[model samples]
Target: MSHSVAEHEPAEVTESGNANGAGIDLKWLSDRVEYGLYQDCVHCGLCTASCPTYVMTGDENDSPRGRIYLMRAVVDGRASVTEKVRHHLGLCLDCRACETACPSGVQYGKLIEPFKVALEISADGDDRPPLLLRILLRHLFPYANRMKWALIPARIGMKTGLIPIARSLGLTKLLPKTLQRMEEMLPPSMPLLPPAPLPEKLEPVGKKRATVALFTGCVTDAMTPETNSATARILQHNGCEVHVVAGQACCGAVSYHSGDENGAKAFMRANLNAFDLSKYDAVIINAAGCGAMLKDYAHLMHHDPEAARAAAFTAKVKDITEFLVELGPVKPANRVEAKLTYHDACHLCHGQQIRNQPRQLLGMIEGLSIVPLEETEICCGAAGTYNLSQPEMSRRLGRRKAEYIDATGASVVAVANIGCQMQIRYYLDERGGSHEVVHPVELLDRAYGPLPGGTA
Candidate 1:
């Protein structure tokens, strides 16, 4: 349970002078991370076991408690941001498993998130993300239509069987490393064929029980459109009127987690203004990461003039599973009849503390049997863009997750997040396993298909 320090705590970075012996000037740390937040860690080591990075590396620096100590030492003017320190902190998946495991209630995300952002600011030259990824993160992923346009060729290749053939023939290796990773992580696009976007307003199937706005996320609509469509249908099936609002932007997680705090706040402000927060009972989000980010708007924009509005918006944002269960899901009569296991997308289980609602929704499927997954709550290495950024560690944890799924002997694997589903499918395919990855709402939609004689 004990982790060794990287170096005998160099004097921490300070604004007045080089507290760290190297004069590295990590003073940006104090601006982003609260000094009080670091004091919350009791160093119990309970979170070490839960951290995916620590579990994989067995290094103290990778564990949450260890990482906390490192950050605290730096903040307290006792440690320098050495390569060793950066390596340990960079390895974090930011899955927030430590927060879930901590008995002392450490807000691990708050400590690490802005810290990472500040680290990027301090180390802007050498440690910046690659240009291609920077382009994708900034220009491409945040815009739904832009993402759809970008994926057009890949979709065409998948449909034409060219993509698989290229992979089998080793042709894709010529591409850049990031593009290659994208090729490898690409899920089967067959399930991407989804019904059209829900109309501006969809009335409840029978009687309107609750009126809610749907946060159809950027990649959710472009990459996995079916889940978005399914969510609306499932909401309607549960007698909820759904509104797919215009001018709604990406939930800003892609930007926020990428160290562009201002960009993320811009996206957040757009979303806050997009929906009429008071009119809806809940703002439903299908993707776990987006839901988590949406729910954190208040915290993210706490000091801004829009803080009150962000707080109100955060109160209404709900993960689809959480809202459905709370709204009392309509039991589906049709039987899915598949042996399945659920992978707890880190954001859903830990970020939102929504472990049971998803399973409860799955349990409603008449004939589907939900088998237990070892380390279900552990991230599958698709923590936002982590797979693309930290390919090696990502694959290590991805394979570990794939191995656990294979051991379960389930034909289908259900996950709530878009990234987790993609990561799980990629690894399962790499190992030649035939397990299918799907969102929990898709299964519920299939179970609630057509409502007797009506078209879905």
Candidate 2:
């Protein structure tokens, strides 16, 4: 791709992007992104194969190196933030697979993350996110209680079999596109029963090996409450005391990624205040996205007054699998009795470099045989809300994932992230597959014993 911006309009926007200072000043990118980070990319094309968007479109503009070049062009006054330029950047999954593929140790997430935020902030009215999506991201997703209450009607419909009937009759078409996608992603099973409320504290089942706090993520806890319950139990089963802070909130990824930089920082600060890092051996997060965001707190707040505290907090943040493996998991004795393939959540595998841990944890279970999945590390096109925003690319990638899952011939598909689980399950359902999509811990929990309400 040419580094020169597409010639449509002159680069008229100043540093403030507008007279009243609404959009980002392209010239000031050095203030937002460390100049060295962009220089780290050698444009080697090695990351192309790993980038989902480039793999799909074969457009260099969608690749990390190309995007880096685009950013450089815009920053150096050689290019304008044209609509076409924005579209290419918007299409990126931000899966950070390129970071895994890059030999130069470039922090791709750091570059793309803040750059996207700046790009969104500068977006003209025509290019801004739709109003409905803005409300959902700003209001609904960050609040656990609000999301739980909001899903009640859908839960009722699912319970009464009305949802399926509505879906079959095309009645769901009346809902907003985002809502329609949510409905489609909802598991086919009737009304999602709320999981048992985890106590603020749970003592270790055998002996107190460590004390840790659990991060009950906003949407993850509200949507799949059982995952959180199971996570707590598994921690307890392995001799760790778990604590849940009542005041804990979202990990701020939704807002941050959506270009609400202040909103993301606010959420991060709330979490920073909510957890006392000194008291716990680690702060455990079950969702991969949440874990990735929690782990980024120190970097996100590097220059803020809470820098010291945020650094302290981030050091203790660990994905449940990462924590368990480091603590030396107690071997699970019971049999799960299933053939399974694991799809690595991009953040868990690429962002956190946690490839072997979840698989190792699963390997400990009896009667569970793991199968290799083709392109298992590829994104399922559910990088948070990408499925709703970029439906075309999302659909293509989701279908691709479903095809791979089908080829596995496994009865179960184990995933670490809720987004991956929901996206894969929805696509698999579309392909008429009945495979079970579950968190790795859910399998471990089953091996330990039936969950709180007893398994189906």
Candidate 3:
């Protein structure tokens, strides 16, 4: 839990054992920071082709390869954590699409996380929000009970017409646009029911073929419980016993992305204690952000001896699409008839290196034609709180994303993350068009039968 500045070392390039044929040799001090990871880069610019920020800003500094160069410079003591460096680094979506395209298989996400941590330590001024905002974001948002208490007031204000009145009076425009979007994106107040705790193990409904544990993430539980219920139903119908653990909280992705290492670690430990990993064939994370985080537990717990055991447990964690794909074909029901477009959540596609599973799963559903959206791999600018913190850029990205979705002429936009869903929903609403932004599981759920609380 103790964070300290990294010790400075003499300027010298360190070489990795495999760097002889791998290209560049990393320096010794750089090795401790895993600067060797960048040595594998051939600078072929393949990463630039897939980089969302690069596509958006057309700036080399905003590209993945460019950021790696900046990181390499810092590692070699050739660069300082200056404002320009920090700005370029901060602009990265950390979407990890670059890794998918890199033939060298550079570990971009892992490399960037440490670089961010080091940057935060080296930076001069505090980049974090006000004290109260920081406390609320770090503590309350990640905790279920506290989040419910906070949502209550927001929900009450929205239901009482205060939010609409304020907007009409031009009061909300005075507030930050991110706050305005948050107000507009609020779904109708739904009942906040506790997650259903499943038995340690479950026998598959029909053939008892596979057993899976579902990690119904924090926001999904409170904001979109239908996704969780639908996931459970779909899995169960497909001869899988679904175990839903109640104690699982946020995947710590939000805090980790914001440089709140302590908050992230605490949530990581709590999640580790919440489930028994060996019991299920695979840990199913429906939310793309949480899915990506679960897969990286080993790297996150690399420094903690006590949490290492739990980290190993996380090695088996799988996104729902990945898990379902591994289970082979499910008997297709001829119920899904809607034409839809699939928006790849950055975490699922790039972060976790899962690109085909969702598409494959969608293909299995009968009567559903998958129309490809333009720039499907680009970030929707909902990188955790990136939309809230950098509203202008977020809005720009969201509008671009909306245009792509609109071009497809699809009635439904299916995505895997709650944040992306909310952001996309906001853009669609602003355009004065009618299109439902839904989770892929919700679409699948509709294929199986009517959802628990009726179809939306």
Candidate 4:
């Protein structure tokens, strides 16, 4: 994990100046993208030793130092994003393990995101998504309402034995295994509901310590509205007024990560319009992915004046665990003692740099024995759309995660992200394991009392 430092200094590039100045500036793009990494690296290669992909592949191309070298070459016009470069970039989980390991304090996450965006744009029309599949994915999967509507047919197909018949007839197997897995992973038909609308304003249950607006994210709202309900109850119990803003749609992290800048911005604007920023002391998000997006709105909305203002307003957003940890002295109820292992959601642990807060909160509950999950920070291969796009890899990662959870011998596996929950649950069910996937908030709600609807 060590490399000799080269003494030759690279020429500095200004933000507005292009290497060739032919309407495209590699230097400018790199300067803007790699803001904090310019002079920081001393070439110790410590980050390479910590990268998971590097650990698995044992290739320099898969390591952080290698990626940095590629980025530098791209900026200096010594390289174009060939298939090799793209493959290396694609392999990254963006888990940010390198950030924690870097003594020079490189901002690897920020540097990599913009690079991904640039690579995606450069590929542009040449890398057009599969026509029929693209339409379905872009239009259907990302929209919560559409996804809910589509789930109905899937449920009907499954319940009426059509899905099994199709599989029996080898029809479904004709499709990619990822699609088949997605179809299989869907829960048995349940009543789907829209997010609960915001009251004009909710008064704090006890003395009003603070007023926080809640973002009922798309996936969480459509698939598991109970998590939001639990969040509202917890917030109210902790002396905060909770407002469930209706207008906020998907946080657009999926689209953003997948290189759909237009869609991501559109969602950001919708979110701004949905939640009134001036009224609440903080914007609270239970979903780690959405929380990360809300927290980074300031940078996301930098291009537009009004949206920038809205983003500024959203700068105070906090993940529920972070907020709860800060709100000290809440009483814990002794109920439903169970052995549990906690899965660190990539977005929560790596994206938000929040590792201990969820563990700390769950530790306070009586009768809950928390066991450590092996490779807790590894991606569950549920990086928003990764499971859908890279099914084989996703399955490999998911199975690895499931085996680790099983080794802990915990009946309940607790996690904070919906993506990880679904990914892990799918693998657990596939393996015929008895373990149940549960959200930390749900456990807390159960400890407090029977949930509002008497449903688990």
lDDT for each candidate structure: 0.85, 0.85, 0.73, 0.72
Error at 203, model 2, angstroms: 1.0
* Per-residue accuracy of model 2 over 1-456 as CA lDDT, tens digit each: 323334312233232243342235654456667888878877776887888998898777777877877676666555677776788888989899999999999898988888788888887787988789889988998888888888888888898999999999999999999888889988666345565567898878776899999999987888888789889889988888899887888999999888888899899888888998778999999899889999998988888899999999999999999999999998877898999999999999999999999999999999998999999988999999888888889999999999998999998999999999999999999999999999998999998874334211
Question: Which scores better on TM-score, 1 or 2?
Answer: 1
Residue lDDT tens for model 4, 16-81: 234442223465365446445745766678987777777777677677877776666666565656
Q: Name the best candidate (by TM-score).
A: 1
Greater-lDDT candidate between 3 and 4: 3
Over all chains combined, what TM-score does candidate 1 have? 0.94
Give the distance in Å from residue 431's predicted Cα in candidate 1 to where it truly belongs.
1.0
lDDT of 3 by residue, 4-31 (tens): 1122111222212122221122342243
Question: Which candidate, 2 or 4, has the higher lDDT?
Answer: 2
Instruction: Give TM-scores for every candidate, taking all chains together and pairing residue i with residue i.
Output: 0.94, 0.93, 0.86, 0.86
Off by over 4 Å in 3: 1-32, 123-126, 130-133, 174-178, 188-204, 332-334, 450-456
> Could you tell me which 10 consecutive residues in candidate 3 have the lowest summed lDDT?
1-10
Alpha-carbon shift of residue 410 in model 1 (angstroms): 0.4
List model 1 lDDT by residue over 1-456, tens digit each: 543343322222222233435323355555555788889987768888899998998766678977888787666556667766777888898899999999999999998888777776566566778989988998889999887777878887888899999988999999998999988877676433434666788778887899999999998788788888889889989998889999999999888778787899999999988999778999999898999889988888777899999999999989999998888988997899999999999998899999999999999898998899999999999899998889999999999999999999999999998899899999999899988899999999999986434523
Per-residue lDDT value at 337 in model 4: 88
